[model samples]
Target: MTDYQKQSPMQAIEVNNIKKSYENKYALGQPDSKEGISFSVSQGELFGIIGPDGAGKTSLFRILTTLILPDSGTASVDGLDIIKDYKEIRNRVGYMPGKFSLYPDLSVEENLKFFASVFQTTIQENYYLIKDIYQQIEPFKDRKAGALSGGMKQKLALSCALIHKPSVLFLDEPTTGVDPVSRKEFWEMLKRLKNQGITILVSTPYMDEARLCDRIALIKEGKFIGIDTPENITAGFNKTLWSVQSNKMFKLLTDLRSHPFIDSCFAFGETHHITLKNNDLTINNLCRWLQQKGHEEIIIQEIKASIEDCYMQLAQNG
Candidate 1:
């Protein structure tokens, strides 16, 4: 409590050994997550938690936003203790939950005003805070929140979340169901907000979006397999990858897995991405084998490792 920010302005959020369990199936952390969760977010930094559904992202967000308490461990938001200063933490941080929790009956403008009023603030006072995002949806201000398009609703939710001008913002899968264009626009808004010195922690299931963050943590089953800049994580992949396609694609996965040199193989879109046990292996060796198996129009080429590829390797190891 000795002027935390003044002492360490770079550290905006700190979480240590946080753990939560549900008595029923709706639990955040399953038995495997008993080791606890730990991570830190820097001030004004764009941090991302990348993972698929049921990865315990929502549970982690709920615990940080103070909507639900962790069974154990500790965390601080903007230097205030999550447990002892839940109220202060709530007021100082903006949280857009994965689900739409806004009022359906209220008009878009009405909902924004309601959220602003909750903190004894007004839309006018925070107009500059969310101006860029709000202007996109202002034309439909009178439309009922329930009737808005998916993209528009996300914009409004973001506006409401920013109306209070929080120092730290937590967005849980803000682009989950949004269209490609909306997702692009949303990340642009986050960059502008980051420039204004607001720390952001966003979660997304899209691996493509991982590169947009300053730093990211690749999460799976309530645990982090790797945490680093996107470039670093992919760069660490020291394996020879190949993209392969053939006329008989149905059995391609089984055939590739059967290959003695194949270290790993997974179907990706229309092609199978595989890595080799020996980097010295040649493509002709694979081509001749497929030809003997009666496969036609076989195409194989080397490719670079992507964030998804890195994740696949980690998840497979465990």
Candidate 2:
């Protein structure tokens, strides 16, 4: 690890009471979106913003990246005000938007050259910076960016982002729409980048990816519900979780929700995740009650809580 990675309390990004809004019909064209969103990232940390579509992830990224100004509140990147230091921030940060923004007609090498030139740097100057990621797609440097596979395109885009050797990297759902294997590869690349002492702030909708980050903030409706490491967040879910499956899933959901002893029930994979209203409720009792309710082929087992489970719990409580 580098000296930068050894710093104990360095903050690379700080956002305070950020607010933004769009026109609202009810308010007679007044702003009507985003309010009081706040979060921060530590230096050399891989922080993740986990949320679904329309959860204000893009708006937050835009504000932090200096692409769009927030209606109110202050955000600083690398200890510089985003508004006053917009130019400096732009030069010191690499932004990989959710969609591929490189020229489709440009070949892999052409795109890299374009970005490098825009930053007033040569590929050789920063070749060592992005060599690990660039080498993966260098063999296809002659191919058009649009002709590359999704995984290859992702790698190329990342290489372009790092061409300038930025201190912070903002990735807005970089893994979305990619295959699972590609997603894994992308994360491995991020880990390598973090190892190089780059502060990475990535947003993703996949709950499973939350576990890979050093810490994650769960966002909903432009607000943060929880922020912690994956293990801590899962550990804080005080409710006992049970996986229940019956012959009829729909009926099982309905019955489970209506059960007096059930606190919450959500469909999780092959089974319904059920939380008890109280610790007094036991698996045998639940099975007997389900059987009495004419639910056959019932299977209930206690299971460890996952980040998804914790997220669902928070969403439900809110």
Residue-pair clashes per prediction, in order, are 0, 0
- lDDT of each structure? 0.90, 0.89
Looking at model 1, residue 248 earns an lDDT score of 92
| Model 2 residue pairs with clashes | none
Off by over 4 Å in 2: 1-8, 25-35
lDDT of 1: 0.90
Residue-level lDDT tens digits of model 2 in 89-139 = 999999999999999999999999999999999999999988888898999
**Which numbered prediction scores highest in lDDT against the true structure?**
1
- In candidate 2, position 189 carries an lDDT of 86
Across 174-214, the per-residue lDDT of candidate 1 in tens digits comes to: 99899999999999999999999999999999999999998
Tell me each candidate's TM-score. 0.94, 0.92
